[model samples]
Target: MRTGVPLRQESLVTPLRLPSLIGCALSLALAAGAAFAQTGTPALPPADEREPIRLLVGLPPGSGVDRISRVFAEALSQRLFRPVNVENRTGARGNVAGEELARSTPDGNTLGVVTATTMILNRHLSRQMGYDPQADLTPISRFASLPLLVLGGPGQGVRTIGELIEVLKARPSTCGTPGAGTAQHLALELLIRSVGARCDFVHFRGIAGALPELLDGGVQVYVEAAVIGLPLVREGRVRLLAVTSRVRSALLPETPTVAETVAGYEAETWLALMGPRGLADSVLVKLEAAAIAVARDAAVVRRLRALSAEPIGGTRTELAATIRAQDSIWGPVARAAGVTAD
Candidate 1:
């Protein structure tokens, strides 16, 4: 009887052990899968199996934004082993492009290059803007920043911010800007208000239109991107009094920043990648990685430097926070300055 009891107990224990081993294997497999996900190695579709990516640019071809977008598109294509194309959808101060991007499918195929003007200033200036930047888009990363240069023409007779302020207060100095609500215009307005100086803004259609006027002294001071102004400065057509970046630019280390003289003043235009809302975490991770890789690439860095723009790659959270902060700061300034596009 004891031998029979031992055999039955052994049979029961064997079945229980088989289930326990299977459960342990399943637990290990699950843990490994979780670990892989945590490492940003989530399973993505094969490059060949995915559709070509469309990089929506808000400016026309040959514009600064378009040029930067093409650089990033090439790098992203190489990284993802897929084709990427730039689509120019220019109109209504980038509202046309922003709306298109916002309305795109949340899938990773469609992305847009956004600027400080498009993401932060447009909404405050135009009530007809179709999309809300904070709600309609998911910021992927900020890839580059273009610093504005404070330029003085022949008649200005100012070589520094202090001299410029004194000139403005002494007489009626005219400042030329690309447009009413443009980054250049806003920066000039902010500077005037911050320093409590009297300066009038002359709105021009574009920088090309403003350049000749500036050279002829019709416009005493002109604030524009370094890329556009630096060539003239090099030729001695204009003088760079100060740069609007918080730190001295690498391209022009001899120049001082506006903050050095104004106590606290900085303004720059930035380029960032963003997608429609509801983007998957895996897709966001992949996009951000590709952007950062491009921003850090030696060749890409050189190209950006040539354009007088600096590579600044950071996480999505950082881009979102920048939009929020800039919106807060620029909104009230725009209102006070009576800057409106529409």
Candidate 2:
């Protein structure tokens, strides 16, 4: 420790030694570059390119929407070669997340997964929506759809749509839905209007609270997503009479569509990928590819179907059309039902 030993032969910054030092540094850099080329390793990404992609979700973790959003996020993380994170920004039935997504920078790194409710019904029901869904958001893809089921527990008398409608028309009955202005609630209203039947509609915070009421015959019939309704049907807690989709659900192949009886009736809630408007077209195309890939992945399709959702993985145009279709259906139903967030 006491010895003053010289570490280098050249003076630290002599003009004569500087060129040699520079030459050595250049040689080393070139060598490193050549090694990287030979090894097929990518050069380090620029600072912005290394940033993680944030995938905002409009629901809480462990909820069906959040779980499905995570599945897409994982697949996208692999496809995009970036960390795609799922952040649960839950409130106002998804508006909280929608508004935030609309305000985020128009980079592919920031995107959102939202349901039909946020895109269509919320705009009609809530006066305080912070952003215009149509104007402020750029559609990417429609990934998953949940076909609702018209369910009745074994304790109820009816088993088919015809029988239920006949009973409902003959005598006023009580029906249940997840909430006042949900897709399930609108479907119920549409059914009532379509069939010229009357039922005192009961709304719950979620289907979980309403399930016990349905089983006990407190409510004659209930409308719920297949993800929640199918398990109850399999357990004999509820009977699946009809599906609310243009076609019958694959999970319940024999079941008739609501449209079969009430011609032109269909209401399916779907999840879509979107970014704030002004996102580059290149970014949208790249994201669309990842979405289509996930939709076509057999394993991913199986997992989504297991969760009672059908995989769509459709183009941005399909998502826009789906949103517009919901506007045609749910907006009218909500108005007829006298529903408003206020």
Cα lDDT, all candidates = 0.87, 0.88
lDDT, candidate 1, at 96: 88
TM-score (all chains, Cα) for each model: 0.85, 0.85
What are the RMSDs of all candidates, in order?
A: 6.9, 7.2
Off by over 4 Å in 1: 1-49
Positional deviation of residue 329's Cα in model 1 after best superposition, in angstroms: 1.1
Candidate 2 residue lDDT tens string, 1-342: 799987778866657578898999999999999999899765655677657998999999998998888888888777776789999999998999999999999978889998899988898898988898888999999999999999887778788898888988998989999889988999888998889999999998887898888888889889998888888788787888899899988878999998888888888899999999998988889889989898878988988898888998899998888788779878878888998985
List the lowest-lDDT window of 10 residues for candidate 2: 41-50
| Runs off by more than 4 Å, candidate 2 | 1-47
